[model samples]
Every structure is written in C-alpha cells, then in structure tokens.
Target: MIDLKSAPELKALEPKLNQFFDLAKTKITAIDAEYDNSKGSPVFTVEGKYTTRGWTEWTEGFRYGISVLHFDATGDESSLKSGRDQTVSKMATHVSHIGVHDHGFNNLSTYGNLRRLMLEGRIPDNEWEKNFYELAIKVSGAVQAARWTERQGGGFIHSFNGPHSLFVDTIRSCRILMVAHRLGHVLMGEGDKPINLLERALQHIESTAKYSVFYGEGRDSYDERGRTTHEAIFNTKDGAYRCPNSQQGYTGFSTWTRGQAWAIVGFAEELELLKEFSDEELAPFGGRSEIEAMMLKAATATADHCIENTPVCGIPYWDTGAPKLHLLGDYMDRPADPYNAYEPVDSSAAAISAQGMLRLGHYLMAKGDSAVAEKYIDAGLKMSDSLFAEPYLSTDPKHHGLILHSIYHEPNGWDHKPESGKAAYGESSMWGDYHAMELAVYLQRLIKKAPYYTFFA
Candidate 1:
C-alpha cells in the first residue's frame, strides 16, 4: 500500500526529507538555547512560550527522548552532551521534589537517558552523576510500584487524586513505570520483581482495554448521568473524580485524539515488552499470553479508530465527536471566554499516532501478519508525508509553533486564535514541533528498515 519498493518515488522526495531534517536540527538547537542551567531546572518555556509548562516534571523526559533521536540521526557530540548535561541539571531539582505520582513521567524519560548512556558507556564516574543515577533508579522503582498499588476498577486512576478519575492519556504516561521495571532489573543484576511490575502494568493496560474500547455494544462510552458525551475529557475537573457525559445522550462519547494516540502507542509498547519477556518470567504476573492477547486487541481497536477518524493528512481534531461549528462572534472575547465549538485538528497527536501505528505494523509483521502489517505501515508513511507538506510547519521567528491551526478542545474554547490577525493561519504550539521532530526520526528509521523486511511475506 505504501509502495516501500518505490525507491524512485522515495528518492524523488529526498530534498524534502533533507529540509525536514535541517528544520529539526534548527528546532533542537533552539530548544537547547532556551535551557537555563542557572534556574536549577529546565523551564518548560522556550522564547517566552510554555513548552513544558503544565506538568513541569515531564520536561526531562521529553528532552531525553528528543536528544536520543538527535544523537541517533546525527553523530553530533553537542546534542548528546546537552542531553546528558540537561538530565544532570534537571535531576538536581527534580530529585529534591520527588513526590509520589509524577515520577512516571520524570523518571521514565530519565531511564531512557540512562539506557542510552550505558549503551554508549557514557555513564560518568563523577560523584554527583553516579549518586543521582542510583537515586533515580531507586526512587523511580518505588514510585512505580506505589502507583500500581493504587489502581481502581479496570483502568488506573489518573493520579493519586483518587479512584474515579482515569485519563486515557495515562496509557503513554505508564510507559515510564514499565521502563523503571525493566531498568531496575538490569541495574540490580537479577530479580523477578521488575518482571512483576511489568506484568502489573500490563494488567492495568488490559483493564483499560476492557473499559475503553471504542467499539462493540455495552462498551463504556460516556457516563450518561454526568451530562457529558465523549471519551476525550476524563474528569469533570482538573483533579476531580467525576465521570464525563455525552453530547447527544446516545452516541457513546469522550474520545480525545491525544488520548487515543496515547493508548495506541502504549499498547504497542506493551506488546513489545510481552514478546521480550520469557514465558517463565511472565508466570507470576499473570502470564505473557493474556497480556499479548490484550495488547493485540487494543492495538487493533485503537489503530482502526485512528485510521477511520483521522484526516488523510494525518492530523486529528481534538475529539472525534466534536461538534462541527464555525467562528461567528466578535473577535475581542475575553481570554477565558468560550467562543469556538469545533475540534481543531491537532498535527502533533496525528504525528505521534502515525509513529505508533508504524511501530504496530512492525509488531504485526513480527507475528507473521504481513499483509495487514504492510497496510498499517503504508498508512502511517502516507500520513507522515501529508503532514510534512503542510506550510504551517515552517520555522520562522514570527511562527509560535511548527504547525498552525491546532485545536486544544472545542468545548474548552481553546482554539489557536492567530495573534497576528492572520485569518488563514492559527497559533503555533510546542507540542506540534516536538511530535514533528519525533515523526521525522521515526520515519527515517522505518524507511531504512523497509528494504530488508518484506511486509508481503
């Protein structure tokens, strides 16, 4: 479907790929420039804009993922050095505030940093670096186990706030916990405990699959009593436990593009872990067979939903059930006032989803589902290409983000209103740029690997 054999076609697109890479390099440099070591922690903001503003602890993880991709693509010592240096600098502040719940995001990415460093033999012998590394591992392991212990019902409660709140986005967030388990086992030399944690995470994932699947009768779509419809919004308030309601009372609701994307990627990663662990190692935590089956189901359901709902260009509106509306009121509404009522297509979410689907294709191929796997891979590649063609991704100082016209949530009234009074374009955001960079690196790898792996086998 994607024509991986089309070397001529791919070669024809070389210039665009080169341009995308150059743009990515520029963005990485810009992010590095925004780093302030004197602040003691990496600020989420870049050039006066909030990059990691909402959940500040996750910046280290984001940086780690980004840096790893950068190093893999370009042998630039500076990029690698910045990644390690930033980790050290950020950990200084993060370790002091190591709370109970957010550690998954903070530490998961840190583990990525550690894994990369260890593989490259870059672990420093310095007292601070050595101490922090061990401390990070221990703290991360403790937090992960504690979080798992607090699960309620089928899915995990979003955070420590309590049982009734479960955000689908946590699917991606939970990977940090799995990473901790894997890394802990490796670091400690031997033990089945890490395997146990991995199994627990899989259980939580299975529970999520049970409750959050988008199709089939009796599937929990919306809390009819809550007066909201949709899968996008999980809780009524920021930290509350109230269930979300549906829009029309019958169209099982609440499906956010990012949340769906998170589950798609999360399930795929779980499948990878399940395959890597031995059958003997998986017995204590509820056997690898069950986990594999659950992951396959989730991967299929989530990938299907993504393919059906997402635009051909690979961008998705905030929520699948968002009401189609247009701007009609005056432009001078208050910052907090609700105005627009449509789901703004989020390029970042689509990009991440495409990467997840690509990974899923590889996973499927590994299991011998060649034809179906190729379809997934082809769709993902085409989606990536379509997203790349969008002009909003141009890197200009006046542009706030890589892609323009992203909708945060129509119900929330957070559309990207252009600041420059440009009716044709919307506001730029950091999330879009980050995902675009991620997509570039992922596609580069996928393209390189396609020649050797036949999807039609």
Candidate 2:
C-alpha cells in the first residue's frame, strides 16, 4: 500500500539512473581484479572489499550481465565491450555445466541478455555474433533441463544439492528454458529423447507454485498463502515428494526473504512471456490462458506478501520473522534501517523484489486490472524512489558494491560486520547489482516508449 502520488515518473528519474549507472561502472571496475573464476562466482561484498564466494557458482553471469545492461541503459561502449568479452571468455563453461543447477542464472543473464539485445537490434546485426549467443543460450537451457528430478507430477530443475532438492531460486533461472524454446531448441535427455524446453519451463513453474508457495488453506501447519520455503526435498529414486527444507534461511518453517522475492519475479516474468503466444502455440502445455492464470496467481500472491511484509520504504529484512525485529518495536511502519546492528536489512531482496512487483504490475495493467496493478506498481516505485537516495545508493567511488545493505548469508557468519562502529552502511551484491540495473532499464524503456523490457521477448 504505497502512495502512488509519491513515486516519480521514469522521465524524472533519468538523472538518478544515469548517475547510478556511472557509479556502477566505477564499482565494477574496482572489483575486476578480485574476480577469481576458480573460486566460484563473486557472491556479495564483505566489508567493502570484493572477494570470491563459494556458493552455487551461479553468480558469474550476473557479473558480466550487469555490465551489458549498463551498456544498454547508458550506451557506454566500454561496458558493452566488457560484458561481451567476458561472456565469451568466462561464461562459455557455464552453458555446458551439467553438475550444477544454475544454468538459468549463469546463462540467461550473460548469454540470454546478449541474445535479447541482438534480437532488438541494439547490437550490430551480425549473423555470426547472433548465432554465437544463440548457441550458448540453447546449450545452457538444455543443460539446465538435463539436471532434472522427475516426480509424479511435473518435475523440477534440481538444485545444486543433488537430485533430491528443488530450490525456489531456480524458478528465476527457468528463463533459460523460455529463451531456448523461442529459438526452437529442445533438451536431449535419456536415450537421446528430445524434451520440450517450454514444457519443462511450464512444469517447473507449476511445481514451484505447488511446493514453494503456500495457499493459506492449511496445506501444512506452517502454510500461509504467499509464504515460501527456500527449498523442497524429494526422493531421488521414485521422485516421491519428501518435505519442506531450507538451506539458507533461519529454519525450514521461516520464509527466507530472497526466496520469497524469487517467486515474485519468476512468475511475473513467465506471465509476460506466456502472453506473447497465441492459444495454439501454448495448447501443447495446457493452453496459454490457464497457464497464464496460474502464473498470475502465484505472482500476485507473492507480490501481495511482499507489499504487506515490506516496510513503508518498500524494503524487507533478511528474514520475514527475523528474531531480533522485536527489539525495534513497531519497525514495519517505517523504512528498514540497514544500520541496525541487531538485525541487518537486505537491500538486495528489495532490489530484486521491486522489479518483480513492477513486472506483475505491468502485466496486470495490460490485462485490465489497473487498480490492483497500480498497488504493486506503486510499491515498486516506492522502492525505486528510496533505493536511489542516501544510505541506499552507493555514491562512493572506492566502494565495491552498487546497491548497499545486501546480506549474502547472515546465518553462517558470512557477511561483514564492522567491529562495533567503524562506518559500514552501503554494501552491494552481484545479483542485486544486476537486477537493480535490469529494473532501472525496465522503467527507462517504458518512459521512452520503446519495446517493453521482457525476458522472453
């Protein structure tokens, strides 16, 4: 429930967007040396210094993805060259990676974004260049689909945690499937059987809706509509569903904020993609209308939750029920104070979630649901308005992160906590940096009335 009147138009935010992208260039340049390919992708900043993180190795594409996005937004040739060169040099391995479940994140942001630009004619119309990006994306999607854990219903893209685990995060990664499907590619599975990328993507979306999102109808004791679990486990042998679990949250029962945000963006994005197809094109996978309806349900529920849970400034804590929030009595009515040492706020979550909110808002508006769409759209704008201001935007040249107050893994003692009082306010993350820029680009395109920003198109 943000005040729509309070949010500025995209045209008015151009200066801020330009400034942020300029600063983004500086910070990325600062971290170029610390990016170590062997140590997995750079996860998040720790104490204002860039360092390698060993998580899923899924964030490397974002490292280059953000640069490409910056180029698209600012027309900076340096950023464009940087993004293209890195994708060619550092991102090829990710497209063929079979051992991990991050093909969507690694490939989509790098190869997918590159291909999208070329399709839009933002890049030079070179057949060889376009084919190179297309091949990478096609391979990446197939590889992602290859790492599947089949179940009784539609299966899911397995997590990095082996065949038994399906992560809510992978929902966002499913865009790789959408891209490959558009390019007329299929995943080759057992006995060289061809698997439909669209079918797999749709199935994964439905599976995520089932296990990741709660319906408030007592599916379980902890079930509440819009609530999400970070991960869900299943039997690898028979694909029998096991139980709800979390690898990064405080507990299995608590909603990890980022995981919640993933559902918001993933479903909204799919809804947009599905809208492009006619009834016949989508009939093979349950008709475009039904699938779009299901996706809208998932996206709207999560967007509602984010709106309710987020503070007035439209940001959330690392966890919805972070134990320490009781200390700051009546905290939700105002902005999330990331400086609170008792419990750190996750700006990264807000950054990612805001974009999803905007996408859902736009989709809803397109479908003639303006009032509801306005709520989510204003909520998204409130976040963008706040994020561009002091203590959120990283204006410093020496700083390594673009958007500040992103906690990578707080439970494992993974984030940097400046000893007592040393001046640690603005921090950034690779995912946050990438998504925020993507979000900015989305808004910017709308203001210019250009081709709407969509992952599938």
Clashes of each: 13, 2
lDDT of 2 at 24: 84
- lDDT per residue for candidate 1 within 258-335, as digits (tens), equals 667767777776676566568887877667777678678778777776776554445555555554412422221211
Question: What is the C-alpha local distance difference test score of each model?
Answer: 0.53, 0.82
TM-score of 1: 0.74
Residue 106's lDDT in candidate 2 = 81
| Candidate maximizing lDDT | 2
Range of the 10 consecutive residues with the lowest summed lDDT in candidate 2: 418-427
Cα-based lDDT at residue 216, candidate 2: 87
**Candidate 2: where is the Cα deviation over 4 Å?**
1-5, 33-40, 421-425
Instruction: Give the poorly placed runs of model 1, Cα more than 4 Å off.
Output: 1-15, 34-56, 92-105, 117-138, 148-157, 185-195, 220-252, 325-342, 397-400, 403-416, 419-425, 449-457
Q: What is the TM-score of each candidate against the true structure?
A: 0.74, 0.95
